[model samples]
Target: MKKVTLKKNLSAAMISLLALSSFGGTVHGESKTGINADAAILVNAETGKIVDKYNEDQPLGVASMTKMMTEYLVLEAIDKGKIEWTDTYKISDKVYQLANAPGLSNVPLRAGDAYTIKELYEAMVIKSGNGAAIALSEAVAGSEGEFVKRMNAKAAQLGMEHYKFVNSSGLSNYDMLGMHPEGTGVNDENMVSAEDMATLAYRLIKDYPEVLKTSGTNYKYFRKGTDEEYLMKNTNALLKDRAYSYKGADGLKTGTTPFAGSTFTGTAERDGVRYITVILDAKDQYGQPSSAERFIQAAKMLDYGFTQYETVQYTLDDTETKDALPVQDGKEAEVKITVDKPIKVRMMKKEIKQAGVELKLDKDKTGEDGKLQAPVEKGEKIGELVLKNEKEAEYILDGLQRDQKVNVYASSTVEKANWFVRSARNIGEFLKDIFG
Candidate 1:
């Protein structure tokens, strides 16, 4: 058997049955639901709330969606001053050959030809050019193999729960014309769970919003007004002017292969609210692989998000308790408690209705009588005020708790009571107990 991974062994009928069991059957209309993919996820870009998901944690082939990682590492290098947009690379023989490979998406590049980092970055981002991606990878880390290590390391740092990068371009090693990164199998392909892809997209947008400038563009000329000029059209069909154009569709990336089928990591913003959606190995109704199917599924995820979700702010007053915590051995008998700050969450209209905060105090800091010990400094962390939702347990994004919580701090300092005051209070309590 070949050493390939990420492709499922289920038949079309079995896949559909799995979808129905996982999502309660495909529905219709404005409340439309269900996605025809092996795995999918929708999330609030600002709040990191997973709005909905289907089999989002299963590791699967991501195809060129892996380029998002390549893009991230390049941007990071530029930000760290390790490289510059004006920096240039002389096309390597392997990259040059891959650029001209038949059937693979690429921008024309000749061996020994020098291209600026900016030009190659555009080719990779705007056109999903495999050669451009590999070239940029080599420039950033000195070799595609080293760059692949950086990609996996960055994925872990970004809180990605499940991912594997065998090569920078996401192409099967066999497709690399025998030039795939050393130590990786020739049949290997990049793999990531939909949840991890969402996490990657979130970190990309958060860490470098500048990427949208390139990914958002629908088309651009690789070498404008030159003899070797080649027009590169964005592979994202949801972009404006495309056959399946959608409003506010700007970035991020799309991919397809016999192994990965069709996948997309899409981001869009409208009225200041942004959402990130991921669809992996999307298939048509009959369970046949189709490039257009990913967009169709993405449309449903985006529509449900935009139409049903809203950003709501929860403040200190929203917490379940405003009661003061009794202080033991302090000059003052009690101290005020409240949430540290306001938290913003993107929730469905229904989730908002039942949304509220729950207060939890630290037991270690409290006395046997359930009172806080004295010498409490102003702004001391005593506990946490957590956002509570009835449906929170059902939310996806595996290994990610979506912990929307803030530290509960003391309103003011409560110094320890002097010996005299302590004695007096002790006597008073003794007398009260006897008289009662």
Candidate 2:
């Protein structure tokens, strides 16, 4: 894998993108409401920005939604040539034993049974089959533990600071004989934050869209050998029930464990706009509907986001070069930089000009000239510009500070040479020209 880095500095274009007044006009200051879930969040799927949040940072158990990450790694393995959809895998004893074990969702695989990767994938995703999860993990990473390592590593790469995985099947914690079994601690399962769940959902839908092939299916049948066949049903009821009228509701994972309660990662697209919502630990005190309650809360949050916000682009012209700072001992003393593309902000028409932009530069490494130099690879940053409105300022800053900074970068190359070498080379050129 190749490493790519970005440097930004946005001091000059502080009020470039934020339309504070626009949002203030549209967003009527409504009273804050509480939901039944322990944690919940709604995010713009395209920008990965949090539109609404509650306890988003707190880590909580994510039930079968853990399968979403499992699905992601499986798809990644297929892309990397480690496995293929048509590849066949033999069911190991360990996997079969786990599948047959009491109190776990499974696809009912027998030891020594063989199934294709595509078949098992459907079982894992649509049926929430724990056996298939284990089988696929073993096929890809040679062991479930190793596959989990990859999962955690991928989470870290995506900035999921509060997530950990102990099993691929998400069946780590179970009560044996009404008492927590010895060595089967409560901490053995997967734990994640609402923000992290959203991040993972975004990656799954954005990067590995092919996984949805099976997840969206309402039912699938697996043929084991010529005489044996079993029908698997989707655990998610939204596909079956149309009354909810969830527009563009599509394939995603759901999870429920005794310890984890109920968890869901749902995605919906309307009029070309997509959104992902996550809810964890949603259970009713009485017999009231918990999943439905969480879904309603998510729908409300999403509606608020889509109705009130839009992504708008603001261009910082290359002609706006007055912000460039002076460089020492370089061919070009200064260079101009501007925003590469228009940015999208959620606001109304009245607040467009009030947005703030902040730019941040990468590490300022000195060059070979022995002067303070920038690694001025074209578009290297001079500083950052932040765009904020009155509300953002009030929250980000102590009071109503409107001005913010956006990043500036070098538009052209700046060449530097050692003093002794440059002096000698200039003399040699003069002598050659005059003597000739």
Candidate 3:
């Protein structure tokens, strides 16, 4: 049986979930709340904030959504130059056999048949072709087992502690005893948490925007030989029409199995903001539309995000500067410190007045003289600025800390202070100290 591993990395925003016991605040109810799947998560693609969640950290059979990881690994290979769009891969017997396997999605490649890496990627993502995934794995790593090692390793690297992979095709069934009574362990499947799936989806699109170009394609055709051409349609019906369209609802992966249920990683972008939603065990039967329920949940969460929260730049304006620190043994007497950017937070319009900034400094670095020494670089750490509101104490804070020792680099004349001049100055200082 195949084995696989995966991990999750929470962004600072999502890390805030640790502070809240639940994300159901304000948003409630079975129908209105964004919790339609057995496991679901809606996170800000850019900020990684948990907008809504239901059994998000719970591990469940993810079915074809396992292909999201496969897609991730493939894009990584392409980004790192291990594979290229134009590169051709020779079909192997293993992949060919899997392609012909009943109930498996495949691109129908025969042994010795070749297709470009780009074409295989489209088949895997657009058509949900398991055989295409196996072929790509072999092409990049020489064997399905070895590629799976890479998959698990990558998962660990991504901090997805709850995931494990058994095969490139996600067909392993080692843990399906309760779900499948036929005693078939051969269908070794890939597993991951809803949070981990969202993490993978975010990273894939953020790192390899090109994958979207292929995943968003609604249809494609590949020729295996002069006489045979396989016309493939995208398995994601959501992409078929404009009726249920959501802006930036681009390419992503979906999956289903009798044991795993319906699962999907759906990504959408609007007004420069991107969001990733993961739903696991969303359906009661195969080839069903239960995954769409999660999409509705995602839309609600995203709408709330855009309308309820606002990102503000809080850079230190000159008008806000209370005072400048003096510089000793430097051409300039002082330097200005300011906030880098405005922070974003969710709040009601009436609560805007409650937002304020607090500045602090490193106590050890600040001298009693209240002046910085020479050789200060531009944009050097001088102080930290924290932004907070009444409801949430602190929403965002810049890394810069107060009293952080800053250099005051000498100007043109000071730059000419050579070793002799420095030594002469040191000798004069020593003589003055002894006399005193």
True-structure RMSD, every candidate = 5.7, 14.4, 9.8
Best by TM-score: 1
State the number of backbone clashes in model 2.
Answer: 42
C-alpha lDDT of candidate 3 relative to the true structure: 0.62
Ranking by lDDT: 1, 2, 3
lDDT of each: 0.83, 0.65, 0.62
For lDDT, candidate 1 versus 2, the one ahead is 1
What tens-digit string does per-residue lDDT give for candidate 1 at 144-181?
98999899889888877667899988786778989999
Off by over 4 Å in 3: 1-32, 172-187, 224-227, 238-243, 283-291, 318-335, 339-353, 368-379, 390-436
- For candidate 1, list the clashing residue pairs, or say none: none
Model 1 deviation from native, Cα RMSD in Å? 5.7
Cα lDDT tens digits for candidate 2, 209-315: 87666776777777745455778877665454533435566768778765556677777777777777887767476734376655566666667667766655544
Q: Over the full model, what C-alpha lDDT does candidate 2 score relative to the true structure?
A: 0.65
User: For residues 1-436, could you state the per-residue lDDT of candidate 3 as single tens digits?
Assistant: 1222221121122323422534212323342253556677767776555666766665566777777778888888887988898999988776777776776777777788888898788788877888898888888888777777888898877766567676666654432222221222344446677777887776777777887777777777766465657888776644536344566678687777655566777777766777677777664344343656545555565566566656543434422444455544545445555444444444445566766655555444355765455445565564555564445221011221222122222122211234675577679889999998
Name the runs in model 1 displaced over 4 angstroms. 1-32, 46-49, 149-164, 270-273, 319-339, 392-402, 419-436
